[model samples]
Target chain A: MLAESLALSALLFTIGVVGVLTRRNAIILFMCVELMLNAVNLSFVALSKVHGVGGQVFVIFVMTVAAAEAAVGLAIIIAIFRHRQSVNLEDINLLKG
Target chain B: MTFDLLNPVQLSSALLPDLLLVAGAILLMLMAAWRPDSDARQRTVGFASIGLLVLTMGLVVWMAVSGLTASDKGVIAVDGFRWMVDLVVLLGAIGTIALAIEHNVRDGIVQAESHVLVLFATSGMMILAGARDLMVVFLGIEIMSVAVYVLAGLNRRSARSAEASLKYFLLGAFATGFLLYGIALVYGATGQTQIVEIGNAIRRFDLTNDPMLLVGIGLMLIGMGFKVAAAPFHMWAPDVYDGSPTPISAFMAATVKAAAFATFMRIWYEAFYNMFSGWAPSVWWLAVVTMVVGNVVALSQKNIKRMLAYSSIVHSGYLLVAVTAASALASTAFTFYVVAYTLATFGAFAVVASMQQLGETDARISDYEGLWHVRPWLATAMAVYLLALLGFPVFGGVGFFAKWYLIQAALAAPAGLTILAVILVLTSVISAGYYLQVVRVMFMKPRPEGAPEPLPVGSLTRAVLAVTVVLILGLGLFPSRLVEMTQMNAFPRYPFSPALQMGQPQFRR
Candidate 1:
């Protein structure tokens, strides 16, 4: 059962990576990053059940960090959009060649 | 088994240095916020920040002294390597703040928040230096990244600064995703995240060849590559260094790079050492590509900051050379090269800050024409820095020894190390093309009319440059002392040593 859950978490992580790579919208990409974090959280819980304790603690910590990352990431995205009036990766060419 | 929160021994041993920095950061923040309008805010921040750093230095010294007598904590790993790196990080932070105080005030950016940023960044670096677990490493990286993002874009009026900050943020976030996922995969394979435990599990399970572990390690390397701006992942560097305030650029080149590399060394050498054969070749190629790209690209840069940015990339390549070698000699070389590079890079940026006129125009390479005639001291300082960057040895610079150590490490590799050595030597020769250009333009070329002359050097800036010059020259002359110190403080690469590789050696006939 634990192996199945862990496998499911890995699948979700791959989906997140695919979303991040395929999506062009900055917001959607960031959502994919959050999804990746959530997948890790699930894996951490499953592993905690396997290991007895430490993995669950790590999962709690990971969630706290994910929340923090979301706050900061959104704030930065908003700031960038405010300055340029766009959130598309292709539109953010002020820094590129 | 209840843990006591207020345990005196735990507080004294495990948490004091971090506590010192956090307190100092808050104090500087409050002081800065207290007088947003006062000119003295910069001074206050400068003195207070330096004072706090000095105190932290004392604490580190105390820790080192006690560590000699104390037992090791596998969870925290306050070992020789951590102590050595902490010293380097603190020194880099102090030098950067010194430069920042002068640069900020000159540019009408004397907000205490600048000081706050330095303190916060230093704290983050401290966390990174001591982290023994994946979670702690992630936290340290976030703290460092957020502060740097603010520092990069502090000058809101400049479109370039805004662009630099955004580029850094987006790329940095992407890398963090790779790192987190890598950690998950590693956890899957090893069922542990502590560096020591991970190594133990890898050995005990004989899982070095496991696809999951290999992918996880590769992702982690990619994540670190982005942070260290290794070849292919270094897109943000030139623009960010060119656009940010010169002092912050200096900070980025020195403190941030040191912190990242410190963690990289720990992670690669400790948690992942068991699988060195799998990763060393990849990192070896990374080192070669990074050196070649950094030097070759720098040759065409007309802007001094951009040139320095590329030079920094080359320096990262040099450090990576040491990383891939992964021997006692290489670790020592890594520490020595880091010190030499930090001092020279910061010194070079300090000269840039001194040469920059207040809000007048961007400093182009042409801006340096006839610098020798106008300000000999500043011009000479820039020349010294360029020579150091080029690994030139006249007047006794340690850059030569730093490279020698790297070569020594490459030689220690059982095979194919000669190719790394050849690439390193070739890149060093290639690097001279750009480093010499700075010197030639400053001294050889006739003065261009309307080019900006060096501004009067402030006391803080001058002092910082002087100290950096001394350290560079001193280290160049007698690097053995520093090398020995680093060796003594260098973290042990363990478990996966001869013991783990006994059954599955890479070079077995």
Candidate 2:
């Protein structure tokens, strides 16, 4: 069970990384990051069976941090969108110089 | 593997500075939310934050002087080393706050929240500096980074500021993911989250070759490498620094680097020393590329903020050399180096902040042309800082010792870091090429035809600049006392650390 769950968690993490890299839309990119974080939580839960409750405890903390990050991250993304009328990463090049 | 939880009193005593800063930040937030209308209240809030930082600095120094040793059951480590870092972070916060006052008003940022965010970030840094467990480190980074991401975009008027904030947030969140994943895998491999316990597990269980452990270490390196703005992982720094408000740029350059490096060293050295031989080579490559890329690439940058951003990256590379050496001397050198970098970087940014007030944003290096003719004092201050950064003879006093001890630490270690030492020397030369350019523009170039009227220097800014300049030269001239102080304030080891594998033993050696 641990091995299979770890494999599934790793697969989710890989997809998250791929989505973050490939997607140009800012919202999608952020969602991918959230996906990556959740993937870590999944692995933590799966590994907790072997490592004890420390892994479970770390998951709760990661969840809290992830929620905080999402709140701040979305607010900033909306701020950018308001200025540029788009949340596409390529459109946010005013600072590229 | 069993451990005991610390008592509430014991924990509070150990965490006094962090607790105080948190309370102060909450109070400041309440005051801000209370009075959104009055400029007088805003000024009061700013002074209040400064007073809070000063109090925290005093508490940290007193604890250091008293030689208090407070470790809380392998979760938090409080000793001279942690206090020394706390002092730097607080000083950096105070300087940034002082710089922020005028800039915030000019740039139309809500003044009270800026100060509140910085206080919260400094508290997070305190947590990071004292953290002996992976969980604390994670929590600390989140607290610090989330506050700063908001800070970067505090100026909602400028579209670039929003861009910078968004970029920093996305990249920062990505890095946190890498870090969390590393922690999860490391825990899976070792069944532990505390540093010393992991070390003990590695030693006893012989899990060195576990794929999960190795990959976890690599991911953590990438994550931390990004946080410190080392090359290859430093894509976010220049754009973010260029776009953020000037004082916040200074804050990010000094405090963020110091805080992140503190945890970087604490985690790698304290928790993972058992795997030192396994990991040193990867760091060797990282140090080399970081130095070369940071310096060589900085030479092409026209924007002063981007130039400093790259220069800060180079400084991170130099500090990484100390970390890769992994010696007691190296850690001590790292502490003094943080102070040195903070003084010079903060001083330079102080000058930059004043210039930005004179109506220059996204300033080019050439904007410095004829600055000497206009404001010789500011020009000279800039010279002292740029020279100090280049580690030139007279002003580089602390920088010289910083690099010298770093080399000495590398040399003292087995022959592994010889190449890194050599590369460090080579990159210092490469860095001079750009530092000298800024000096040339300031000193030799004739005053430009259309230069703006000089900005009046704020009293608070003047104080920060004066103190940093004096300390830079003072520490440069009389470095040994500070060196001895840092060396004496060795890291506190966990109870589970082997007699042969701990910090006090290194001092005895």
Candidate 3:
């Protein structure tokens, strides 16, 4: 059971990573990051059955932190959108080296 | 005294400084919101934040002097290393707020909330300095990164600032994902979240060769690599530093990096000491690449802020040498190096902040041409700061010794990182290419015709420069005092007690 669940979690995490790399929309990139975090949460939940409650407790902390990050991340996206009228990564090029 | 975190009262007391800072930050947040945003309100809150940081520094020193320790089951460290890093973080915060109070008026950032955010971020850094558990480390990093994300965009009037904020937020969150997954996997492998317990588990269970543990450590390294802005993972840094307001850039460069590095060292040294063979080579490569990339790229930079950002990256490489050493002396060296680097970084950025004209963001290296002709003292101080960053002897003061100790630590490691130490030297010489270019521009070039004189140095900024300059030179001349202090504060080696382990909850029930 643990092996199957862990394998599923890894698959989800890899998909999230690929999405973040390929997606140019700012909001999509952030959603992908959340997806990655949730994938890790799944692994933690699966591992808790093998280990102890620590993994389960870590899942709660991850969720709380991810929520906080979502709040800040959305507010930042809004701030940028106010200036450029677009949430596309390619358009956010005012700070290039 | 030792803290037993399982006891509520002891946990609270163990967290006294962090609690105090958080409480103070909340009160200041209320004060910041009491009035509509204005320069006066921002300045008032900025000063109050400085006062609060100073008070917290006092408490940290008191705790360090009383020699507090944490039991093995505790999730927070109460040791000399934490106290020293806390002092550096608080000092950086104080300098940052002082510079921001004056610089924000010029940039038209009237939000008092910016200073309050710095306080909140600082409290987070304090938490990071002492966090001995993976969960606390995650919380601390998130708190610090979230506040800094907003501070980067505090100049709502500037699209550049907003862009910087967006990029930092996205990359920072991505890094957090890798870090969290690493923690989850490590937890799965060893069934423990506490760093000491993980170490004990690895030793007791002989999990050194376990694939799960190795991959977990690798992921954690990648995540920390991004945070410290080591190269390959450092693509976000130069842009973010260039676009953020100058004082915010200084805060990110100094205190934020210091806190992150402190936690990074603690986790590696305390938990993974037995796996030194497995990790040292990876870190050795990281140090070398970070140094070479930072210096070589900085050489071609036209913008002064970007150049400093790259220089900060190079310093990260040097600190990584100490990490690779993974010795008690390396921690001491890391502490000393962080102090010197913080002072020099704040001083350089103070000069950068002062040179800006109202509402302009021109920080080109060319703009500093012949500064000596107009403002001799400021130009000379900039020279001192740049030379220090270059790690020049005598004039660069503590900067010289910072590198000296780092090299010593690298060479003295049991792994004998001779090649890495040599690369460190070669890269330091290459870094001189850009650091000296700035010095030459300030001293040798003639003033451009009809160039407007730089604004009068604000009193607050002037004080910051004077203090940093004096300390850099004084400590440069008499570094033995700091050397002794750092040596005394080195990470306690193998503070693992069987009695304390018995108190910990079993992971493999």
Model 2 spans > 4 angstroms off: B1-5, B358-360, B492-509
Q: Estimate each model's TM-score.
A: 0.93, 0.96, 0.97
What TM-score does structure 3 among the candidates reach?
0.97
- Full candidate order by TM-score, most accurate first: 3, 2, 1
For model 3 the local lDDT of residue B426 reads 93
lDDT by residue (B193-300, candidate 3, tens digit) is 999888889778978788899889988999999999999799999999999999999999999999999999999977877766677778878988999999999999
Worst 10 residues of 2 chain A by lDDT: A88-97
Model 2 Cα lDDT, one tens digit per residue, B1-509: 11133767767777888999999899889988886745566678888999999998898888778766654455888677788889889999999888888777677776577788989888999999988899999999999999999999988888989999999999999999898889989998999999878877887887767888999999999999999998899999999999999999999999999999999998887777767756777777788889999999999999999999999999999998888877677888788888889889989988998887533467788889989998888998899899888888776667777777777887786435677788899999999999999999999999888777667888898898889888888888999888888877645452234624433222111
lDDT of 3 by residue, A46-85 (tens): 9999998988899999999899889999999999999999
Instruction: Provide the DockQ value for model 1.
Output: 0.47
lDDT of 1 by residue, B1-509 (tens): 12132456753456578788988799778878876545577777778898999899889888877754223224455666777777888887888788777777556675678778888888888889888788788889988887888788776555567667777776777788788778877887888888767876887888879998999899888989989999988988988888788888998998799889999988887777778787887898899889999989998888888989999999999899888877667788888888888888989998988888887426678888878888888888888888887889864287778788788888885443777788899989988888888788889888887765566888888898888888878888788798888777665544324334644335211
Q: Score the docking of each candidate (DockQ).
A: 0.47, 0.91, 0.90
- Residue B509, candidate 2: alpha-carbon lDDT: 11
Clashing residue pairs in candidate 3 are B397-B476
Q: Model 1, B303: alpha-carbon shift in Å?
A: 1.7
lDDT of each: 0.79, 0.85, 0.91
Whose lDDT is greatest here? 3
